[model samples]
Target: MVLILIAMQFYSPTKNISPGNHTQIFIKETNPSPNLKALFETSCYDCHSNNTVYPWYNNIAPISYWIDSHVKDRKKNLNFSVWQNYSLDKKDHLLDEIEKMVVQAEMPLTEYTYLHGNSKITDKEVVEIIAWVKQTRIIYQLGKQPK
Candidate 1:
């Protein structure tokens, strides 16, 4: 078992790092307030966006694999890094989902918060996120997508 664990450390999934402002488009379109944007950078972007600020444990064996899978699944659900690819309707729906998840405290996952103490969103932050989502959805609903 020791040998197997050691061997697992030899391999790791590719890191998810992108150059420049990968989420600029998403920010331009959604326009989250400064505080809300900071919340996303610290609490949410790691998994939900293409850029991830990997933790030290990520250098370990199975933990690295686990984080990779978790990030992949989250990106599949909503990759703010690729937000421009989503249609207006899809963006609206995703924003709706974001509101639901945050309000229910299902986001930034409990296990994630354990390791990332600061990632835990306060009730006030959740309320702010919900408000931001509501405001952003208005742009999509009105078909006022900026080019």
Candidate 2:
């Protein structure tokens, strides 16, 4: 078992790193305030975006695989890196879901916060995100989003 674990360390899962600003388009379209953008980067981007700031533990075997799986599932659900590719309606829907998850404290998953305590969003921040979501959706509703 020990040798197998040691061997596993040699084959870490492929990381989700993107060159340049993977979220540049998304940031341009959504127009989050500086504070909100910081919130998303610190709290929401690790798993939900193409670039993840992997922790040191991720160098280990099963933990790397587990973290990779979460990133895959989250990006599939709502990859901010590809926000530009989504239709306006999809953007609105995802914004709603983002508000709901944050409001319910279901995001920045506890398992994630357990390791990344600084990434946890507080209730006050949730309120701020909710407001930001409502305000941002209006741009989509107006049908004059940025190109």
Candidate 3:
């Protein structure tokens, strides 16, 4: 077990670092309020964005793999950095999912909040996030409608 653990340390998963302002389009297009932007950066960006601020534990073997898997899965589901690539219907669906997830306290993953307490969403923050998501969904839905 010890030997396997040591070997695992030598092979780290590729980090999710992007070269430039990958999320710039998303931020500019969404036009979230300052507080909302801050909330997203603090609570949602780590796994949902192209850039991740890795935790110290991420350097450890199996833990690193676990974190990598989570980040990959999150990006697969909704990558804010690639927001511009999604269709209007997809954007609206994503916004609806975001609202549902925030309302149900199913986001920022429990494990994530455990390691980063500040990432935990408060009741007020949840309400604010859901409201913003709903507003955003309206815009997407309008875009999806026939002219």
How far residue 66's Cα lies from its native spot in candidate 1, in Å, is 0.6
Task: TM-score for candidate 2, please give it.
Answer: 0.92
lDDT of each: 0.91, 0.90, 0.89
Count: clashes, candidate 1:
0
Which lDDT value does model 3 have at 13?
Answer: 94
* Greater-TM-score candidate between 1 and 2: 1
Candidate 2 lDDT by residue in tens digits, 1-147: 999888889998899999889889989988888988898898888988999998998998988889899899999999999998899899999999999998888998998888888888987888888888999999888885555
Best by lDDT: 1
- Each candidate structure's TM-score, on Cα atoms with residue i matched to residue i, is 0.94, 0.92, 0.95
Give lDDT tens digits, candidate 1, residues 1-147. 999889989988999999889889998988899998898998889999989999999999899999999999999999999898999999999999999998888988999899889889998988889889889899898895555
Model 2, position 114: C-alpha lDDT score: 88
Full candidate order by lDDT, most accurate first:
1, 2, 3
Give the range where candidate 2 is weakest over 10 consecutive residues by summed lDDT. Answer: 138-147
lDDT of 2: 0.90
Superior candidate under lDDT, 1 versus 2: 1
Candidate 1 weakest lDDT stretch, 10 residues? 138-147
